[model samples]
Target chain A: MIDQPARARDFGQSRPHAGENPPFLLTTSSPGRSQRRLAVCVLVVLVGALVVTAPFARIPLENTEALLPAYAAAVFVNEVITASLLLALFSVQRSRAVFALSIGYLFSGVMVIPWALTFPGVFESLGLPDAGLQSTAAIATLRRLGFPIFVLAYALLEDSGSSARVSHGSARSVILAGVAGVVAIACGSTWLIVTSDDALPGFMKDTRNVAAPWQYVPATAVCLYLVGLCVLWIRPRSVLNLWLMVVLCTLLIEIVILSYLSAGLRLSLGWWAGRLYGLLSASLVLLVLLSEKTTLYARLVRSVSAERRAREARLTAMEALSASIAHEVNQPLASMVTNADAGLRWLGRQSPNVDEARAALKRIVDDGHRAAKVIEGITTMFKKGAQERVSVNMNRLIEETLRRCRDEARLGRISVQAELDADLPPVMGSPVQLQQVISNLVANAIDAMTAVAGRKRVICIRSARRNSDAILVSVEDSGTGLDPKYRDRIFEPFFTTRSDGMGMGLMFCQSVIEAHGGRLWVTDNEPHGAIFHFTLPSADDPPSTAGATVR
Target chain B: MVMSDDSLIAVVDDDESAREAVAGLVRSLGFLAAEFGSAADFLASDQRSRTACLIADVRMPGVTGPELYSHLMASGTPIPTVLITAYAREAARDRALKSGIRCYLAKPLDPDELLACIRSAIGDGKGRIE
Candidate 1:
């Protein structure tokens, strides 16, 4: 049926390498040049900030007692949101590395509340369990130590190739276990620190300065962060790895400023800047993930709309093709009906005209045969697979198509000239399909020249050996050239410039050529008009009688 | 105005088989039938003046059935035309009727209807031959 073309809709799955394939941007995709450059730019900016702030690191500012609680609140919000987003990604990807990092963020975010409550002055009204000064410092050391350790774990597991081994049902359980473990560890560490404050070392000196030994904790964290950075750099880098390196740079800068450069002062300029870097580190991956997901969403919408347009085009082509089929088949059926009536009328006469009746019956039989031929042609057009292939001489095929189109050319005032290479090899394909392709091209050429006046309308068809193994055929028209913008779109189904055109002609030609393992394209003819060219692979061995003379 | 047994009825169609079939049917009814491949062919022949009635395929390559009919009427040599179309649409039939076409018939045409249409086209009730 003519409607079968619509049912066999090509959803753009065939041409994977034709510049229309969707881009992969998640952790699975390696970082491209632009992402690498952007990461480098961020590194330069962060390092530049550190260099500028180093000289003023020792200057002490007045402590706003409210600042610690507020900073902790902001960090809590940033880390929790970042953790939730990562977890959401983990659920989709089922990646162990992402799960570890998300749990690390969750641990840090949850620990901040208790750390701030025990800090001393601002949250004293809450009567929180405060173990003098060491309480806050202990929680800070745990969070700093836990975060980099998780990063180290992430770097180790990222390329383990076990990400997809976790089934969907197990992914939920794993996520739950990770969240519960982080919460339990946070609570236990907080309970152990506040209860055993007497056994803890004094890392803070009179609430304004940190003792020298306290720097060892951040220094140890720095070492872990550096190791994680080395592991990530050694592994194949994805967009996630690229941004994580930037986040790690910020972490390195923050630790250096807070521990080494601030001269042990709690509210110094380096300390304040270090806190801001902490917030920046938490937000970087979150921001990148959000933007990448947005781009992925946009690409999805575009592809879906493109598929919808292709579907609609196939439907329209089907409708147009069936209408033409109806018109064609009805012609013979009408003739047959009239002939049968005439046959009966002749037989029914008072003086029966037997000879005339016999002629009418013969015409009816001929009409029936014509109708059957019409149906056979239609069926051959659609039955693309399992068709018998034979060695076909290209020049012979071209001559036959031109002969068939003779009346059309004469009516349209178009002169068709054939330029054949007499020594061309035979190509392997269904002869009927190849003939249809040539006929369609010739018809289109005539249609293109229908509007021309002053200039001569000439269609030049050429057949030659393209290479040792391929035969190339070109149909050129000396009419108005095709629009440059419509070069690719013209081959798309149901895309037509002609008002009365069904728009299936070029699409049919392209599909046929492609099915025969050939390529079809158009180029501008010299001075004026367009030339359509197609190439077919020559058969392995031509049959003994396959060579047909070229005219 | 009764149509005689020898009244020439012209059948024009692009399809040779359909043209011949219609001409065969007309001849069996005792009318003299002339078959043409197109309206242009019919017009080029002397049958244009002698044709008592015209049966033309509605759609053709160069000039359509309705267009040829209008051209003849405009030239002051009006011939009653019955249009047959495989690609029938209601709007086209209505427009052809409004333009003074004698009859519009769809493909796989009912022969009885065609005979009556031809009878009415040449001269209504008195046009039928004994």
Candidate 2:
């Protein structure tokens, strides 16, 4: 059994976005060319700005120590904000990319404070014991390298389908355990480096003191990572992958500025520019992820309102259906009651007329059965289950439909004509549904002619073999023709010209025809009116047979 | 009540059972009855002149009961008419009354009510003749 309420709630919670865009906002596959162009344009602008500002950036500052707290605060704020946003995204849709990204942010945030404190000038200025330049370089290297590696891992794991294997409950627990483990590692590593600065290699210490020779190692590593990221960026599999490429690109620019162009002293223009770029790179993925979450929430609200409107339409349809049933059943019942009463009057005579009474009694039985048959047709039509299809004679079905609407046609002063081809093959479809289609068409034709003055109120219905595999049916009316603009929209649900019309009649007819593997449409009638046409495939033909040749 | 042999009661209805049943009820009340499948058929017959009290269905093929009554009044032969309907619409009843119909009854009509209506129409015919 399907859990309808739960499914509805899920729609309310995680509704899919409408229109051409997918719920994963940035995962568009076809926009790679444009995105590449945008990347080039941004790269050009950044390079030009750097070249123009290099002369002014060469001047050294009076005190680099004054800027250390501000730089540390900016890094801390960016990393923490990014981490929280990634965590929120992972909670919404548990994925390997989101989990790795969140942990990476947490690591960067935790390591940045220690990196700031252990920097040579900042540490001595704060009057704390100096954890030498080597320790600070190691921590800075780890923090810078952590994000790109995690991002690359996320991009490579796009099609791994790791998220599908984990259940919702297990995924939540895994994320929590991963978060705790990262915190422990970050704190433990920071403490080890701060307490015993000698654990670092002598070469790392020598490189930190000179800063020129050993910088090439990290610079070369960043360039190689940039090349790898560019290759992956060419054909990003998801939104996260694309944004990750942008983050990595910005990180490469920051690394080039800090390790290649900047002087050993603090507060250089290259240093400030590199830090600003790093802050931007850290926030890009989180911004994209958070925006996607907001779009998903907006989609949820739209879907809930759409469902509520659908429910209201269904209730209105039910009311209309009941009214139709009452109208149909009342005629036969009236005859039954009158026949029974007439039968009694005949039998109560002084000289009892037995033969006449028998005739009246027989009519009562017939009328009762007729009413029962009407009820049976209604119940079968509305029955909620798989519909049964069988070979049906189009001519007989049309005749029956006309018979049902004969009284209304006559009362409306409408002359109905039928031209059914005798040699036409039977079509495969549900009899009741097809009957309703014809009945509705005929009724509409009569309604359309109700207001016509000084014109022949005629409704012509015809059925013929359109091809070897299909048969065509048409209902033509000599009434006011539909506007050419509304010709197509007339079949849409809740679209109607009549004030009293429920507007579901044509929509229901179209659906019934479509369900029978056919097509329904309308055209302008000759002279002045409208004609509705539909086609059904022959029973002997396969479902994939060529469509009927009818304009 | 004995209706005059010369006075014919015309029954107009589209349904075979309903038309015959109403005719049978008219005959049971001792009136000479004639049946017409449609208002057009009744209008074409010579029985229109002889009909002292006409019992017709409100809805029928070609010409409805109220329309037939209007046609008769327009032609200056206003016969006393009783309208019977299977579907009871207040608008139709009001239209029939406005057209000067003697009675408008909904089906399964009470036999006594119909009999009383026909008897009074016959009585009025006699009074008008005198």
Candidate 3:
């Protein structure tokens, strides 16, 4: 019985996951993400060189004093795009990694405006109150420091596969806190720079003071963190993690270049290159994430279609089963009605034929029980409940299944021959499900033989002890043999040869057999036709008995 | 209104218990009953001309009730058939009625309804014979 929720979960389970089925060679690398990372690396290198060469080579391009506004606008656009992309990624899958990354981007995008406003010349020229170069340096330092910290946190969360997600209310609070913190830092730094510009150290006064001892502190700390992150990357993880590590590596190189170019004036080519590298690092993960999102969407579409097809096939199978159920139930009902009438007639005689009436009443009782059993069988077979495994006599179950198919066999001019080992042991399984397996096989055999002319139609069912621990049952039909090409695909769900066939019968049989810790397979019978064989562990087996005993 | 026991009603059904039970009811109604496992068996038997009414299941192995009715009609021996079915298909009932079947009844058949159909079928047969 397949419940809707349970089957939906099964569909989710069918999706391939990295940790679920690990590769034989445990490597944390992905070629696609690696290629994207390489592209990012090349872009960073080209931009880094261009920025570094501009000041020393005395290019026609103006210095930081003139190009400041254009640089600020470019940084603003990059930051905004990065933040939006991160938020989009967070929306798709609310992981700690994405949340942290989004917050980092948001902070950087907001801080860039304040950083540009206080960068000495640009906003001061417009008569806007500027926080001076000290606040500009502080904002730049804070922005650069913010990204790596968030990225490292994201990497840590990725390492812990089941990272905790923030609740809705808490997440909103966290975002509010982050915005307040960024605003506070920006305002506080401006206030300090405005009130005490002369009290600040020489390193904060200008971009050319790279030799200041305080400047090395944040750079060394960032380098140490980057090294630690590199160590984490040495171990195997997902493709996403690997790409993030690559981004971090490039960011580290950009940091080194930024510190080196800090010896030059503001908006020096190296400083601009450093900013470009930062933009590249931020964009790398977003690009990979967007590509992954596309792949996931494609997978989702494929699975949904596959699920729909499976459902359609199941409906078709149910229709066939319902027809069979109607026939099975109706026979006994007709018998019961007839017997009741017979009993009444016998009793209505002038000299009541009591013996005959008693016989008719007995038949009525038997037919009533038969009808009830048929209803019970169908209910149990189709019920959306967990299957209950019990010790079931295989021979008896096969006999009952054959009895159900007797009418079909007769109509098809098919002879059914059952050879049962008298001493065969019972197996543990759902009797109704097992019975369905046999009935489907027998019914299929009967249907297969309908096309045969002149040749004797014979269906042979055999049950024997495969060993002390297992019992084997086989159904063989003397009909058109299975084609070699279709033999492998016969058990695939919805793969059908007949126009009227739903093609789920064999697949259902195989699943039931496998769920019972058994194996079901097909083979070519001698001369003609096909044989389906399944093996069930004997009830005497300790493992199988354990399951039934628990019930 | 009295009918002799020699006036036989043939009950053809794939089910043994149903065939025997219907036969028993016919016997109690002052008619001799002949039971056949299937329509083919009834056709093979020598009781076709003597049978006053034919009560047969709609679905049978070799020949269905309506098919037997048609065969009889084609042979110039139109037996009054009351077709019994487990599945109450309106199309089958319509087809059976159009082919001049006396009645079409679904299974878990009402004994009273069946007896009435059987009596009416016998009356029709007798009228035709006279």
Model 1: CA > 4 A from native: A1-23, A162-164, A348-354, A385-551, B1-5, B124-130
Residue A263 lDDT, candidate 2, scale 0-100:
48
Q: For residues A1-551, could you state the per-residue lDDT of candidate 1 as single tens digits? A: 13233322111111112221123646767777988888899889888999999999888767566787778888899888888888887765556788888888898889988887887676776775446778888888988888888877877877575332344335668888888888888899889898888788878876777887697898898898899899989977878888888888899999999888896577788988888898888888888888888987898899988987886787787988888897778888888888998989899999999999999999988988988999878766775463777789888888777766754564465667777777888888889989989999989999999999888788878877886768899999988989988888999867899866668889889877876778899999988899999988788534332233110
Q: lDDT per residue, candidate 1, B57-111, as tens digits? A: 9988898899999999999888889999887799999999999899999876777
Candidate 3 lDDT, B1-130, residue by residue in tens? 4665456889999888677767766665556789999887888898876898999988888888888899999998888899988888998788889879999998777777877998888787765333
**For residues A1-551, what per-residue lDDT tens digits would candidate 2 score against the true structure?**
03232221211112222222223444333335665566567667667766765565545555666777787888788788888777765655545666776788888887888888887677675688877557777677678777667766656544445332233334558777887888888888888877776766432434223354456556655965686586566644455566666677777777767666664334677767777777777677667667666876798799978987886788687778877787668776777777777778778878878998898788778878878888878756754353777789998898777766654664465667677777889987779889999999988888889999888888878878887888999999999989878887999867889866668899889878876778999888889789999998888786555234210
Q: Put the candidates in TM-score order, highest first.
A: 1, 3, 2
Considering only the true interface residues, what is the Cα RMSD of candidate 2 after superposition?
1.7
lDDT of 3 at A125: 67
Superposed by TM-score, candidate 1 places the C-alpha of residue A477 at a distance from the truth, in angstroms, of 52
Full ranking by DockQ:
1, 3, 2
> What local lDDT score does residue A98 receive in model 1, on the 0 to 100 scale?
80
**Fraction of native contacts (fnat) of each candidate:** 0.92, 0.46, 0.60
Which prediction has the highest TM-score against the true structure? Answer: 1
Which candidate leads in DockQ? 1
